[model samples]
Target: MKGAPRMPQDDADAPRFARRVGILVTGIVAVSFWIVTLLGALAVVTRFVRTIVVPRAKRTEPVRVRDVDLARGEIEFDADGDSRTPGRYSFWFDDDEGHARVGDITGGGAVTVTRRIIGVDFGDLRGVSRGRLGSWFHLAPGEFGHPYSDVTIETERGPAPAWLIPAAEPTDRWVVMVHGWGGRRPECLRAVETFHRAGYTCLIVSYRNDGEAPDSADGRYGLGDTEWRDVESALLFAGEHGAGGVVLAGWSMGGAISLQTVLRSGHAASVTGIVLDSPAVDWHDILAFQGTLNRLPEPITRTVVRTLGNGWGRTISGLATPIDFARLDVLGQADRLRVPIHILHSRDDGFVPHNGSARLAALRPDIVSYDEWGVARHARLWNYDSDRWDRSVSGWLTGLEG
Candidate 1:
C-alpha cells in the first residue's frame, strides 16, 4: 500500500513544471518593464508639450506700433500734431491711430511692453526701456525731377553736400554711388573712376555716419534703415544737377538701400536703372546667418535674438531708426519690376550670398541681369577684375541709353 501511494509522476514531469514557472516569470518581468517605460515617455512628452511648445505659440504676437504723422513745421494744425517733446518721436501712445501717416516709430525690447519705438525715440514713451535719439534719415545733395542735376543739397543739420565733380565738361549721364557701413563715398572710387572715363558724371553721397556726417543713433549700424532716405535725397539731387536719368549704384548694404530707393513702389518713375553689388535681401535672414556662423540653433538663437535684438536699433546705432523689413521693401519685389537692373556679386562673398542676386534674376528675367563672379569677396569684384567689371557695367548702361 505504501509503495502504491508513493508513485512519483516522472523526472520529466518535474522538469516540465519548472520550465512552465520560468516562462511565467519571464513574461511578467517583460510586461512590467514595458509599462514603466511607457509612463516615463508620457511624462517627458507632457513636459515638452506644455513648457517648450505651448508657451512660445501662446506668447507670440504681431508688433503694431502706431505712426503719428505730424504736420510739416510750416503748418499749425492738429491733424497730426504731437507735442511729446521737441523733435524726438514719442512712443507712449498705445492705440492704433487709424491711418494718420505719422512719423514712423518702430518698437521692441527685452521686457514685456505693449509698444516700442525704434528709429527715433523720446523718453516720454512708456513700456520702452530706451529708444534711439538721432536723425531719422539723411539727405543727399542732388536735383530730383529736373531734366538735369547740378546743384547741392544741404542736409537738415549738416553743411552743404560736397560734390566732387570730375574735372571735365559736366556730363548729363550720371552714376550716383552709395557705400556701405563704415564706408564713405571714397569706397566707391574704384568704380567711379571707370564711369568718369566713360563720360558718366559720378557723385558719391555721404549718409548719417559717413565722411564727417554725425554718428548714428544707438551707436550701432542698421543694414538699411535711415540710409535709404539718404539715397532718395541723393537721387533728387542728381536730378537737379542735370542728370537726364539716374543710375543708382551701391555696394554691400548700400546696394540693398539703393534697390529699396529705386523700387519704392508708388514712386519709381524717375529712376532709369539700378546696380547692386552683394546686396542683402532680408535682414532677418541675415541675422539667422549670424546665428549659424556662431553655431547657435533654434530656441537659443530665437531667445538671444529676441532678447538683445529687440533693443538693437535703439541701443546699437545710437539712432533708433527702426528699419521695417516689410514696407514695400525692395528685396520683396524682384518681380513687378519694369525697369532695367544689373546685379554684381561674387561667389566668395562672405557677408551676403551670391544666390540673392541669382534669385532676383530668376524672379524677374526681363528686368534683372545677374553676375556672380568667382573671385573677390563681397563687393570687391571690381578690384579682382577691374576691366571686366567696368566693361560689364559701362557697356550695359550704354546699351540701355542707345
Candidate 2:
C-alpha cells in the first residue's frame, strides 16, 4: 500500500524546469569560454564532412561551346553584364549576384557567343542584403532542367547528379566540374566550357541540398563530406565511359570537395590532374574570414559553432544557415594524392582571400602548378579580362598535357 507512485503536479512546472536548466547550461558554457569554441569547431567540421555525400540532379546534354581558335575566332560576349562591349551580342548570365540577360562585352569577352551565357553576377556586393544560401543552391535546377544523358551513379547518401556533355570527338579525357556553396551544376559551365573546348568531355555536377538533389538521405548538407561523393562519382562515371584521364576542378567550397575526392580516389589511376579556383584550405580559418566580412559578432559566431558540434549536426546543417562556411582540411589528405595540381586565384578576391590557393599550391609542390592573378573577383578574373586570364590558365593546363 505504501508503494504508490506520485502523480505529475503541474505540466507548467516541467516547462519552467527545462527553461531554467537551459539558461544555466548556457551560462556555464559561456563562462567556460574556449571550451565551447573548441567544441563548436569540431561540430562544424564533422557536419561538413558529412555533407560530402549528398545526392545530385541529373543533367543531360546541354548546349555549350566546344572550340575556339583563339585568334581569328573570338568568343564575343560580356560575362559580367557591364554592357561595355561596343558591338557584341546579348546573352543570359547566371551568377551569385542575380540572374540577368547581359549585353555582349559586359563580361569583358569571357564568352565568344551571345546565344546563351552561363555565368552569374555578384562582383559588386555593395549594398546587397537578401536571400538564403539555399536560394542560391536551388537557383540552377529551377532555371535549367537537368542536363545529362548518362548512367546515374549512387552515393552512400544518395545518387550523385550531374549535367554531362559528351565530347563530339571523344578524347577519352573527362573533366568534372563542382560548384561552390549556393551554386548548382550549370553554374560552373563557364569554367567547364573552357575544358570542353580543349577536347575533354565535361560533367557539371550538382550535390544534395543543391539543385534538384535537395532531399537526399542525409536531408542536410555536410559541406563537402557528402558533396565529395558527387565529384568522386563523376570521375568514376567518366572512367567507365572511356576516359583515359580525369580532371577534377572546383570553385570555392567545391574546391575542397575536389581536393578530398582526389585524395581519396587512389583507386582511380586515370585522375591525373587537379584544378582549384579560390579554394579554402581550412574550414576554421574560412569561418573567421567570412565572419569578418559579414561583420558577425565573434561571440555569437563561436557559440553557434559550438552548438553545431554538440549535436548530430544534421539538424543544424539542414537549417542551412549562412554561418555554414566551407571546411577544407583536405590538404592533410592531399598527401595521399599522386596527381598534378593546378591552382588559380586572384590577389583581389575580397571574398575568399588568396591564402587558400597559396597553401594548396604548396601542399604538393612536386605535382602542383600554381598561378595567381591580380584584382579579379572570385572566379571572375577571366571575365574581367578574357584575353589575359583565360590565356594564362588555359595555356598552363594545355602545356601540362603536351
Candidate 3:
C-alpha cells in the first residue's frame, strides 16, 4: 500500500502541520514584542531630549507688523489666535540705540495700540518704528531702569553670571530668584520689585545649561538634580556678600531646583524661607500630567519614569548616567522642610499639577503656607495679577517678621 498509492496517514501529517503553525505563531509574537520594546525605547529617548535639553532660540517670527498708523497711535499685527485673546500684552522693539523699548497694550484686534513707550518716554506712543515690534507679555527689569550689577558666581563647573539688584531701603536679607525652564533672568523682574520694596536685595540667578551659564558635561538638564549645586554656589555668593540670611524664590522648574538646594545643599541653615511659584513639587505627577496632555497613556509615563531613574534604562533612553528623578519628589519629603515655605500655584496651571502643591501644603501646614490662583497657566501668577501676587508675598514677609 505504501509503495503503490501512499495512502494518506492523517495522524502523522496533522501533527507536523500543527507543529509548523505553532512555530509560526511563536515567531510572530517574539518579533512583535521586540518591535514594541524598540519603539518604547525610542520614545523614551526622544522624550528625554525634549524634556531635559535646553532648547535653542528660534528665529524671530517673520515681522508680523502689517501697518502702523502714527496718527491714531495704533499698529496692526498677527497673533497666535484672535488678536482679541484676553490677556496682557506689551509692544516691544529696539530703539535707535538698540535698547529695548516697550509700551503697554491698550487694545487688541487686527489693530492694536500701545501706551507709555519706554526710552521714547512719550505718552500715547511716539518715536516708534514702523518696523516689527516684538510684543511680549512678560516685562523685563531693563524697562524700569532699576539699577543692577552683573556679577558672576563661581560654581563647580565654572563661573555663572547673575544680576544683583540692591534694594533702595537696603536690608541684610537677600532674595535669590530663579526662573523656570527655558526662562531667563528677566522673568524674576516682576517679583524683584516686590522683594526690593520689602528691603531685600535680589539675585536673579542663571544655572548650568542656561546658555549664559557654563554648559554641563552632558548638556542635558538634571531636572534639579545637579542644577541645585549651581544654586548653592549663588547662595554662597550671597552669604559672602552683605546677606545675613536668604529667602529663596523660584518659578516652575526653578522651584524644583530651589527645593532640592534646600534639602540637599549644606547651605540649608543660611536659607530662612522659600517661595515657590507654580512649582513642580513632584516630577512623577508632572510627567504623568504631561503624558495626559500629549495623549500618551499611563504605561508610557511609567516606562519613561523608570527609564529616567535607572542606569541601564537611561542608557537605552539615550540619557547620561545618574539622573536621580526620585530625588525630585519634593512633596514626598514635605516634612523635611525645616524653614517656612510659601507656595503660590495656579489651579489652571497647564504644566505642573497643583495637587502635589496642595498635598505638600496640607502635609506640613505648620511650616507651609499655600496660596492658590486660577488666573493664569504655569509660572504666570504675577502676569495675571501682579497686585495680588505682590500682596501675597509681602504678607508672607510680614508674617516672617512677626
Query: By TM-score, who's the top model here?
Result: 3
Which regions in candidate 1 have their CA more than 4 angstroms from the true location? 1-152, 216-219, 265-267, 300-321
Mark the regions of model 2 whose C-alpha exceeds 4 Å error after superposition. Answer: 1-99, 103-151, 157-160, 266-268, 310-328
lDDT (Cα atoms) of all candidates against the true structure: 0.55, 0.58, 0.74
**Residues 1-402, model 2: lDDT tens digits:** 253333337996677667766787887788788787777765655444343323333322122323322233233322332223232121222233343222233223454333233333334322222211111212232233323464456655567666677765758878878888656665576564467567777777776677555355546555565567667767777777788888888887788788777655544566777777777566655666666665656764564455444444445444343223433365556576678778888787766778766876787788778888875566555455556645665786797688
Question: What's the lDDT for residue 214 in model 2?
Answer: 36
Q: Roughly what TM-score does model 1 have, to 2 decimal places?
A: 0.57
Candidate 1 at 239: error in angstroms? Answer: 1.9
Measured by C-alpha RMSD in angstroms, how accurate is candidate 2?
Answer: 12.1
Worst 10 residues of 1 by lDDT: 73-82
Candidate 3 per-residue lDDT over residues 152-179, each given as its tens digit: 9999989998988888876789999988
lDDT of 2: 0.58
